[model samples]
Target chain A: MASGRPIQLFRNMTAKIAAIPMILTALVIFVGGTAWTVVYSFTNSKLLPRANFVGLDQYERLWNTNRWIVSIENLLIYGICMLVLSFIIGFVLAALMDQKIRFENTFRTIILYPFALSFIVTGLIWQWLLNPDFGVQNVVRGLGWVSFEFDPLNNSSIVIYGVLIAGLWQGTGLVMVLMLAGLRGIDQEIWKAARVDGIPMWKTYLYIVVPMLRPVFITSIVIIASGIVRVYDLVVAQTAGGPGISSEVPAKYVYDYMFQGQNLGQGFAASTMMLLAVAIVIIPWAYLEFGSRNRG
Target chain B: MANPATISTAVAGADTLPLDGPQGPRPRPRLSRRNIFIYGTMLVVAVYYLLPLYVMIVTSLKGMPEIRLGNIFSPPMEITFEPWVKAWAEACTGLNCDGLSRGFWNSVKITVPSVFLSIAVASVNGYALSNWKFKGADIFFTILIFGAFIPYQVMLYPIVIILREIGLYGSLGGLVIVHVIFGMPIVTLLFRNYFASLPEELFKAARVDGAGFWQIYFQIMLPMSLPIFVVAMIIQVTGIWNDFLFGVVYTKPDTYPMTVQLNNIVNSVQGVKEYNVNMAATILTGLVPLVIYFVSGKLFVRGIAAGAVKG
Candidate 1:
């Protein structure tokens, strides 16, 4: 035991001290805060945290409320469409860019520039662009298509799609960049082998290369899916869940309830639902992604 | 990795064999049908991406009457910078008509300190985790990384409560902390991966010289990890600048960041809509990150790839 000078508690003292914020956040805020929100969702608190248990009242109310139901439905539609379309569009773009095209740098910079702008800007731009009288509709009408109906912001049933246009415009570029990275990561020898075999490029890409890019696909899905889950700001900035709350999303619902309405229990329940939805998507994927990490 | 010269050489090889002799005089048109298709599609998509920006620029430059009259696709018939001037100096948010400059300065205040502090924490934490090997460091790191997935809405109220309890809820400083907390997982993941990917010999050599943890971090790790720090700064500066939810939720009305202020100014329901001013404000709000994006170029791509691949 006397072999050592001393085993002080502060041996890596700087590290332990430096890590206090991360440790506190990981523990107190992330874990503890999420658990607290879940627990408080069961309470009847209004405007402040309280301990009065209210059982499933909040949950039932949340489900029964047309706004909340609409939020979930919109989330589903947006989530599915954004996920599928972004992947397809992104992959196709990446494939095209991978075709040894000229002006690759220019195309990449132009396409990816939107990823730089905030959602607020994207929403505002799209909002003006979609304005019924003076936006794309009016411009097209002036160009002699007076019967054109390109207005999506003003339509309730299709307002989510309106938000979708902005979201896709803002998002797909990042997906393409990620996919391009994936495509570039692939070995060219595979392409050479396919060429030597007289296999068509499309067939080679579909059969051999697509399967090879599974990890990249998974990574893209995770990024896009998470963005879909947190699809509040786009909706807020674009539509403000307008046309009678038609494009309302759960994140917006939770925010509105908690802050504007001061309905804490309702907001908590809605957010708990949001967390649950993310968990549903993330858990299985995380299992496959990280679960494989351990074994690999 | 194939340079232009190599690609042309390969094409020249293919070209000489089939259509003409190896010394054929004429070169085929570079715009083959396939090249046309690829470039055409990319050009269209690029235009689709550039449309909003073009509209923003010209729309902001035109007079309000001209904006109302002219098509968004057309360049301004007569350009004016009045909107830009007004948006910067006199655009009203409630009783304050001092324009987005306040919000701009506020965002600068928030973003600079937050970026520096977040990088500082992440670099140290990453160095410690990679080299020091504390007993339970990885466990906490795992939790923190996974914690990034938790919806910000859930933690919003709790953070408000915490900050309020500490008497910093509505302050800009409070928002800085909020950004750091949210930015931690990605930034840390970034710095950690970069640090971990460094040659093990460097760390070992430093330790062999009796360099303690702080000494090594400040002396060896920080200097060597400059690129990663820039990536982190790129990520945080754009991210914090673009953040609307936290800006709205955490800051007071006047103290709101540019994104929040722009939203209020443009989307305000009271006054008659100033289309040109609104466009100018939107562009101004977007300019910080846009400038950074254009300036940073490939580093921005590397930054995102780092976050994505590692996350």
Candidate 2:
């Protein structure tokens, strides 16, 4: 009995000890990091972080800044475009593949190969292809159709769309993979029944298959949404937020202020805003995911 | 299991003739039509997806004069390795003009240790959390998963400040620590789900044999986790290698990763913008991850599919 008591005590102690590092690391990185960013946002910190606190001045300045406002608007547009377009394209492609067409492995690989390439390279390739002087525009012009104008990368109004095109190219493959998995999970009986019902293939896809893949759709949306928020490298690589800051997004803006512009206060404020934006969208979904998971 | 004709006729309207029906020996609707439609659509999309890559490769191989002539799809009039050589040997990335070789070594230095440390820590943490039932263990796991959703860029400033205060900022050690810290969530998530799916009897049997936590984890759990270990390694390698903002913000110039150099080369606004050289450099920078993907394609799919299945 005495030996059993010591063993139980040791088990209890080990369990507690095992949790310590995880808790400490989480607290340090998440809680402490978030608090530090919030505090820095209120300071007059620049380049190197200074501790002279100036309440809400940076936030006020951020609100007033044209660049920050433009960045916010651009992010909204870009995020929505990327999310919707990639999903539609990915879903269609996956559906087409589900038809059990020939060269299935080859087609799947072709669809997925772009995901293996880094976004940095993907962005550069897109940039070259979108360059008016040497890209598709010139080729079209060479075909004697001189009226062609494919200068989206150069035009301020359309550059964001250009970026979206590149993002969709890289992202759709991932969405297709996810949706394909979902499709594969589906019972073959459903397809067989629908075929027996004499339902058109398009109707079956639209009415039955799409709705049944709700979980996959939700997961894809969440992943892609987070990706849109953190999308900096692609913009930096492709257009450099160029044609006069038309393609600027919040992450890139925060990066610029923190590093290039040497305005840490503004950078932190921008970051705080981004955090708030993400929280607004993610918290509710997170609550649902957790609540459902726990109930299950 | 109904007759094929009945199934087709049921789907088709009663008045509408069957697609394969004989009415005056109507033109046969070939079985190949549906296949043709599906394959043809996929082929078109594949071309669209691969078009830019085709351009990048062709552009990288062409002479500057050919590139300037502006036919991206056509065969290069004159092939040249000059751009590839220049990109590797003489591309300017700021005051340093030694191409990306130095940055490549820096990337290797950062990536190898970062992958090892993160995987080790995550494996331990995952084993403890999934297998050991402890007060606050669930909470800790939750927070770690939550940390994955928090943008790493948002945490960059604070992490830099914290590292500086500890007298480790701008050093290789500091960068490695940062990578480990950021990598914890994904690696832990990967392993925790993996361990959760594993049969508990294995652990119970090990315990009955008088094995302690560390012994069972190191000897048994770690060995069983080879598939996930590969997944984690691939993720860390690709992520750390392709990372630009973190590398630029964290490391000193002497320790800058290859992505930073690639960024500098491709991002130069003042230079005459050598399209061929930039394409070559970008492809070179991505070579490691591409190789990993090609070589470990099957393992990569299995690892990710397993993780996703649990979710």
Candidate 3:
């Protein structure tokens, strides 16, 4: 079974040729690009990228800038609220839909449809819905609650929450679908056994079933969390970091500096921070999933 | 989708709908206090989900005069196709008053080729990894999948530079390549798992019959894998269509994709705000993916579930 030229590069010539794009992308674009951004972030490149070193100056300015600070804080608020609310809403909806209710397809379709639309569309629709003159504020006020003030788009403080509403509206549907998938994956015998033991369905779900769906939960969290980090278009379409940059997110900050501001160094620094944030979330998940699998 | 009810009942083992069992009059299940609670809450949540879509449609149909009287929840007094017409052919972005036609065409150009090229490349890569198994293919595969999670911002400038170096910067072809690059990971993971799941004996049989790598992939793997290809198609079409950041970054303003241009039209500050036109444009931009979502139905779910599990 000895092969001639054991490690010859072109053994399977077409296969090797077919793999060139993936190889180039993995090596040059993804790896090279990320490294380039991190390195350029340390330099004083403005408008055009250059090798002129600046020794943390961009990072210093990014941190000191009010908009950047506000972006982080908006991200935190949007992240935490979106995280907590979407999960709760999603899990609850999944649980309810898990019931032997009628019209499940219709309900599921209606809910999941929003997940199809782009965030830009989501933002614009919500922008219209929240408009002070024609939106929820006017409608509610028209409904006899004349003192209603639900204009989060214009209000600086809760403008993030305004965007959060639209975000949740668009996102929770996917979360529900994912959770529904998880719920459906639960073994039926557990439910039968719980019923035989006289355990209430709620307690059965809370105490027994949720833990079994840990992988699904982890997947949703990672999906939702990564989504939270890259939430730029939604903000752009909805607020454009409006009424004095109150709802600016880190991703938007990165975009604005790099392209709009033409401050390449600053954008690189900001994007590097984004990269760091994603790494924080992804590294542990990768290790937990793959590391133990390798040995086991 | 093979009867949604049956699928749920099979998965959930909860066909306990009282008094309405379709198969032979089974004893009615007890109507517990819990039934009402479960459904009422779901109705509320469903309404919350349906609100924006309902509002968008209703708002888009109403005339600008009614929109000024603007109760978004109300149905239109007189439905008008004028806004749709305006959005599709007459809406303005800066001095470009030619409506969303430019962006729509630009997106069509970007999405079609990007989808085909990305899927073609990824499926082949997946085939090679799963079947051919070169000396270091898995290493590269690992790095490629890992790269998916990195914020595009980190890769954004570098991609620009790379595209520029390759003489594709700010061009439609360059944007197409960017979509292909970004779409590679999930598409590859999808096809790899798919191809690997096939019976190994087929490949062995084909090999003994003198089929080479390309021969097997082209003759065997592809024809058997059409459904997975459709699923991959659904994922890529939706994803690349919805992408804003890459389109905004990689393409010039004149060639911006629909989502980017849609954002510009709705959020552009210079114009006297036209809510009806904005709503019309919003729906027009979303129409492609939304239509796909409705038509593809169950496959859309399968695509996302597959994407979610791997990605």
Q: Give the C-alpha miss distance for residue B82 in model 3, angstroms.
A: 0.9
Candidate 1 clashing pairs, residues 3+ apart or interchain: none
What tens digits encode model 2's per-residue C-alpha lDDT throughout B210-305?
998888988889889887889988878877888877888898888898887788888886678898898889888888987887788766556555
Candidate 3 lDDT tens digits, A155-223? 999999999998998888889999999999887778878988999888998999899988888899999
> Runs in model 2 with CA error above 4 Å?
A1-21, A47-53, B1-31, B305-311
Off by over 4 Å in 3: A1-7, B1-32
The 10-residue segment of model 2 chain A with minimum total lDDT is: A12-21
Clash count for each candidate, listed in order shown: 0, 1, 0
Q: Per-residue lDDT of B166-200 in model 1, one digit per residue for the tens?
A: 99999999999999899999998887888889999
TM-score of each: 0.95, 0.91, 0.94
- The sequence of per-residue lDDT tens digits that candidate 3 reaches over residues B215-293 is 8998999999999999999999999999999999889888988898888888887968878889999999999999999
Most TM-score-accurate candidate: 1
Model 3 chain A: worst 10 consecutive residues (lDDT sum): A1-10
Kindly give the stretch of ten consecutive residues in candidate 1 chain B with the minimal lDDT sum.
B19-28
Q: What is the DockQ of each candidate?
A: 0.80, 0.57, 0.81
